[model samples]
Target: MSKIVARGAGVVSGMIGGAIAGAVFKQVWKLVAGTDEAPQATSDEYGWGEVLVAAAVQGAIFGVVKAALDRSTSRSVHRAIGG
Candidate 1:
């Protein structure tokens, strides 16, 4: 049960992080392009296809980061335990 909860929390954290990173990227791109206007969001502009692609990419990145953090924590705990 604890493992499941931890996994869920990790996923939620990843999603939030991804969204924030995406927003930052969008803003930076706009700034670099010298566009003062906000981009328009049309129903067909960003459909499920774009969303899924972005999610997949972000998910992979998040997964790798989470795995690395978990491994580092495990190693630290092991060292503290003199193992």
Candidate 2:
């Protein structure tokens, strides 16, 4: 039962984390690039450097958000299960 609960929590947390990460990335990109839109890989207007930088920043943000949320959820579930 605890495993089942943890699995469910993980799924929910993952979804929430993705949303938070995406929003944070958008804001960060706006500040860093002075634009609301991050360049897609195939965008002709942006050079390779610009596209790579945006991808790196976005990946970092998403990783941090996911790790944080996963850690928090695991701890909460552990405590709730009296472990």
Candidate 3:
């Protein structure tokens, strides 16, 4: 039962985490690039360096956010399960 609860929580938390990460990345990109939109890899307007940098930053933000959310959810589930 605890395992099932954890799995369901993981799925829901992951979706929420992704949304949070994307919003965070957008704000960070705006600060770094002074623009509201990040560059697409196929966009000709942005150079390879710019596109790669954006991708790297976005990836880092998503990774961190996911890890944080996963840990938080795990801890909450553990406590609720009386562990």
Candidate 4:
């Protein structure tokens, strides 16, 4: 059924999308902070601005990835169902 396919594809695509976003965030963070290790808010070494910026970047990347994957998976499911 198309509904089942959509659900399964959504779940799988969501997981993969998260992974993609995390990888993208890591690369972007390294570029922005010049280090692979992300800053923690609780750490005094990293200021509030740095921590907030990292969070914002991660959230943005995740949102973008989710949206893209959702659209792609929906189309794939429809095609699979011959709709």
Candidate 5:
């Protein structure tokens, strides 16, 4: 359905945006902290637990942001249509 496709596209865009933002923030943190790498456990150094936790947090944040934006856009469209 069109709604499903739209939602999927939104999620993909959110994920891409989140990833780029996360990477930029990580780099900035490194620069500020004078570190060469992220403080979190690297893939090769740690088990899946850390990675999964980080991912879940990121996903939740991304979902919340995406939902807020979607709701705002929908309201704007309804207002435009005098609904």
Candidate 6:
């Protein structure tokens, strides 16, 4: 029962973290690229450097957010379960 609840909480945390990461990525992209729209890797308008950097930043933000949320959820679950 506790494990099930933890799993559900982890899912919820991931969803929320993803949404937050999207917003953060957009803001970062605008600042880094000086554009509101992010560039696609295959797009000709941007060079490979720009596209790769954007991808790396976005991925890093998402990974960080997910990790933080997962950690917090795990701690909460541990406390709730008195473990």
Model 2 stretches with alpha carbons more than 4 Å out: none
* Residue lDDT tens for model 6, 1-47: 99899999999999999999999999988887789988799899989
lDDT of 3 by residue, 1-83 (tens): 98999999999999999999999999999998899999999899999999999999999999999999999999999999966
Off by over 4 Å in 5: 1-42
Once superposed on the true structure, which residue ranges of model 4 sit more than 4 Å away at CA? Answer: none
Residue lDDT tens for model 2, 1-83:
99999999999999999999999999999998899999999989999999999999999999999999999999999999966
Question: What is candidate 5's lDDT per residue for 18-82, written digit by digit as tens?
Answer: 67656655665566556555445556774687556555655665666667666765565556554
Going through the candidates in the order shown, the clash numbers are 0, 0, 0, 0, 0, 0
Instruction: In angstroms, give how far residue 46 of model 2 lies from its true place.
Output: 1.1
Residue-level lDDT of model 4, residues 1-83, one tens digit each, is 67887898899999999999999999999997899889887899988888999999899999999999999999888887888
Residue 45's lDDT within candidate 6 is 97
Error of 1 at 59 (Å): 0.5
Q: TM-scores, in order shown? A: 0.47, 0.96, 0.95, 0.90, 0.50, 0.91
Q: Residue 43 of model 2: what lDDT? A: 89
Task: List lDDT for all candidates, in order.
Answer: 0.56, 0.97, 0.97, 0.91, 0.60, 0.92
The ten-residue window of minimal lDDT in model 5 covers: 32-41
Which residue ranges in model 6 land beyond 4 Å of their true spot?
none
lDDT of 4: 0.91
By summed lDDT, which 10 consecutive residues of candidate 6 come out lowest? Answer: 30-39
For candidate 6, give the lDDT of residue 43.
97
Q: Which of the two, 2 or 6, has more TM-score?
A: 2
Candidate 1 lDDT trough over 10 residues, lowest sum: 35-44
- The candidate with the higher TM-score, 1 or 5, is 5
